[model samples]
Target: MTAALCLFLAAINIATLLAFWWDKDAARAARRRIPERNLLALALFGGTPAAFAARQMFRHKTRKQPFSTYLMVIAAAQAGGALGLALA
Candidate 1:
């Protein structure tokens, strides 16, 4: 189960990395078009790390007010979750 979860996370992370790497501008623009609820669903379903990583790497949505703060918090939580999963 853990291995599957890790694989899933890795896949998502890689996808996000590729998306950001290919065309950061397009990714940022695509993000704007997506609903916040959809993004939140992705984050909640273990994609937070990828989303946060993409935000940092692509410099997308990092300058806003509440969204920036929320993303930071979510990133921290995701790190904590990953650490806990590893330790368990």
Candidate 2:
């Protein structure tokens, strides 16, 4: 069950990344309109890594803003979670 969950999360992350990579401007526009709370919810549900990677790869949402800052924080948390899982 844990493995399945991890796989599902990873797939979602990958799909999110691909979506951003393919259309960063569209994604950014959607992201801008979407509520920060919802984005955070998505990250909390295991989408942070892809979100962060997309931000970096597309150079999107790097400006100094509360939303960007929150995304970074979530990215760090995701990294920690991944590290912990790996170590375990």
- Write model 2 residue lDDT over 1-88, tens digit each, in one string: 4899989898888866765565556665665444457555667677777877877888866673997888778878878887998899
Clashes of each: 0, 0
The regions of model 2 sitting more than 4 angstroms off are 18-23, 27-36, 76-88
Cα lDDT, all candidates: 0.66, 0.72
Residue pairs whose backbone atoms clash in candidate 1: none
Stretch of 10 with least lDDT, candidate 1:
31-40
What's each prediction's TM-score? 0.57, 0.59
What RMSD value applies to candidate 1? 4.0
lDDT of 1 at 27: 59
